[model samples]
Target: SQQGEEDPQALSIQEGENATMNCSYKTSINNLQWYRQNSGRGLVHLILIRSNEREKHSGRLRVTLDTSKKSSSLLITASRAADTASYFCATDGLNNNAGNMLTFGGGTRLMVKP
Candidate 1:
């Protein structure tokens, strides 16, 4: 399957804590990206790490990729109420006919407590 799947569909954490989510896929990809969607807003790109890369960091966000295992993970440090949102992992499939397009996973809903 080309779809990515995430674990722990939901997570709750106190403010200032950290939250982590895992994703797995069943196909070869050129890259993987992490995105965040606020309550009613569209998805916002968080980070994109190529298949050759094993780890990447952006501000308070950290992403790790294990291509051999077809899995990736996202970690958000210093959680806040504003950080409450749905997180999704998208993969860039390797296709000759189709250019790069993001394929999103189910997603993980994060809730930050005050």
Candidate 2:
């Protein structure tokens, strides 16, 4: 079963602004991964935060994970037109073979205006 669900089916923002996306899951997860996909393209791994970590940063992206709340958020600072894409949150359950099993959320469509 899919464990994560992203809030705000869509988002629109101006360039240079910040975009934040949230995801909530139903099960305990070992780690959460965020991905970005351009229109009709494959997903690109953005960042991954383990259950033991609260926050992680990669370039212009910041991710936070709260195991207690079963939620995660992704923040993209200084948004650009190129940042327009669909963002997805994936979670790996706490099972022994969970590493190979990733459940993905529906995703949030972000439109960054130039």
Judged by lDDT, which candidate is best? Answer: 2
Would you estimate the TM-scores of all the predictions? 0.94, 0.95
Residue 90 in model 1: lDDT = 92
Q: Tens digits of per-residue lDDT for model 2 on 1-114?
A: 558999888999999999999999998888999999999999999998999999999999999999999999999999999999999999988873636588999999999999
Extract clashing residue pairs from model 2.
none
What is the C-alpha local distance difference test score of each model?
0.91, 0.93
lDDT value for model 1: 0.91
Q: For residues 4-87, could you state the per-residue lDDT of candidate 1 as single tens digits?
A: 888779999999999999999878899999999998899999999999999999999999999989999999999889999999
- Candidate 2: list runs displaced more than 4 Å: 96-98
Query: What C-alpha RMSD separates each model from the true structure?
Result: 1.3, 1.2
Residues forming the 10-long window of minimal summed lDDT in candidate 1? 93-102
Q: CA lDDT of 72 in candidate 2?
A: 97
